[model samples]
Target: MAKDFNENDRLIILNLYRTHGDHYTNFCEEFGYNPKCAREIIRHAIKSNGVELNHGEWSEEEVKKLKKVVRSLMKKLQLQSYDGIPWSRVSQKLHRSDVQCRQKFFSKSTLFKMIPKNQIDGWNEKLDIAKFIALLKKLNFPDYNMIDWDYIKEKFSSNYFNILLRKWREMRIRIPNHQHLSLYEIVDHLYKTRVLKLFGDDPEKMKEIDDFINT
Candidate 1:
């Protein structure tokens, strides 16, 4: 006896799928439901509210087009803010409210999906790695005496600086003998570790890292 999905559950399914494709696996993982059950909810949405899925909510085609527009705008330097995202322009192009556009684009689910796919195309991971390694060496690793986070933020985009640091810390914890490693060695170690593969294999991931070592 499967439980019936309420409107909220259906909306959750729709939102997750619209904002993060293949969300059925996540729904199953989060809710202890099997993939079949997770998928049934989406099927139910299509059958019961076909118009809503196609019109009110973003259809698959619409999301794809929106992603392209967002990508194009992000590449134009003049259109970006400090965070390097231009949500208002994205909203106008998508014909959706800015708030909604922002929520959908930066939502936890959306970012989770985007990172591995290389869909969020603006950040140069190479520069980020170079700057991060330089800072870590400058501070002499584990010493906070002269570390100024603001300077690091300036070196990397404010939106992603913290994430980069956190990633570095995570990498440090995973690998041993890091204390004696040079900056290049540390970067190489990070490349070998899971840190570099943060974006797993996704068929849609269009971008490849063209490593541009700044220093």
Candidate 2:
């Protein structure tokens, strides 16, 4: 059982995230408390404020291993489109039933190489799992943290620090290496830039972008 934390401990962590620094690795190193414990404290703080956390699923290493195997098979079979092959065919390829693959992805009645591939990726991999999960809870559901994050990357060129810095740039104006700015403004700026190339409707480029933004 998680020990109920007192308000005082919550204040201490709030102060750390506020005053000292917000690095979980640093917080654990300094206080010698489990990092997960720190997260619980933050979650409690948010919950105390009546704000539920946003969350998303991510792939585990085991799932990644399976995905890599599937990707390899797809490449070998030249199966790039959704209609190209059926799961039954892939079952023969991998010796796994559809149920098994769904279990690996934490989903049911869903099929990949169809419309559910990105959802699977979202469940299993989040470019950077740490930020993605935090973002999920922070933003809650029915909000697009992924789009906000993507725009943040396109504008700032870095995930964490640059997000804070690049928020100051005016819309449609290019800054060198994304100077002081914030994420919200980044999305607005992208709309102004007409550079939808980053967010265009292309499948293969989108894949490369997912890899790029997450990698």
Tens digit of per-residue lDDT, candidate 2, span 44-115: 444333343222233355455556656666687885332233444444433345435434432322223323
Q: Any runs in candidate 1 off by more than 4 Å, and if so which?
A: 1-55, 78-82, 117-215
How high is the CA lDDT of each candidate model?
0.54, 0.43
lDDT of 1 by residue, 13-79 (tens): 6676666666555755575556676577665444332323332676667677666776677677654
Clashes of 1: 1
Candidate maximizing TM-score: 1
Per-residue lDDT value at 170 in model 1: 53
Candidate 1 TM-score over all chains jointly: 0.31
**All candidates: TM-score:** 0.31, 0.20
